[model samples]
Target: MVMETIEKVIVNLGASDIDSRLEELLIDGILYAFQEQIMNDDANVMLNEFGIVVNALGQRVKPYLPHICGTIK
Candidate 1:
């Protein structure tokens, strides 16, 4: 529920409007969630949300690509 809400918020805010610091924090939190909850069913939902957030982030996601891809792997 929370991740869905966050995804919506990020999507509504769009990429340029999001602050870099907040982007870092969101990426960190999502990565941490991926690391800690990969075995759970909720992880699937989180992964979906993560993709939406990544798209919402646009070019801002570049720096975190490797980390995100590694976490997904």
Candidate 2:
């Protein structure tokens, strides 16, 4: 529920409008949630929301690629 709301907000705001520090914090929180929920069957919705947030960030996501890829792997 919260993740969905966050995804919507990010999509509406767009990447450029997000402050770097806040973006970093958001990414960190999403990544943490993903890692924690990876093994949970009910995590699909949250995972989807995380993906949308990542996609919405666009190029701003570059710096976190290694961490993101590592998490996905």
Candidate 1 lDDT over residue span 1-73, tens digit each: 6688888787776667768898899899888877877457888898899999988887889999998998888
Give the least accurate 10-residue stretch of model 2, judged by summed lDDT: 34-43
lDDT of 2 by residue, 1-73 (tens): 5687897887787667788999999989887877776457647887788788888888888999999889867
Segments in model 2 whose C-alpha atoms lie over 4 Å from true places:
none
Which candidate achieves the best lDDT against the true structure? 1
Clash counts for the predictions, in order? 0, 0
Give stretches of model 1 more than 4 Å off: none
What local lDDT score does residue 65 receive in model 1, on the 0 to 100 scale? 99
- Per-model TM against the reference: 0.83, 0.79
**Candidate 2: deviation at residue 68, Å?**
0.7
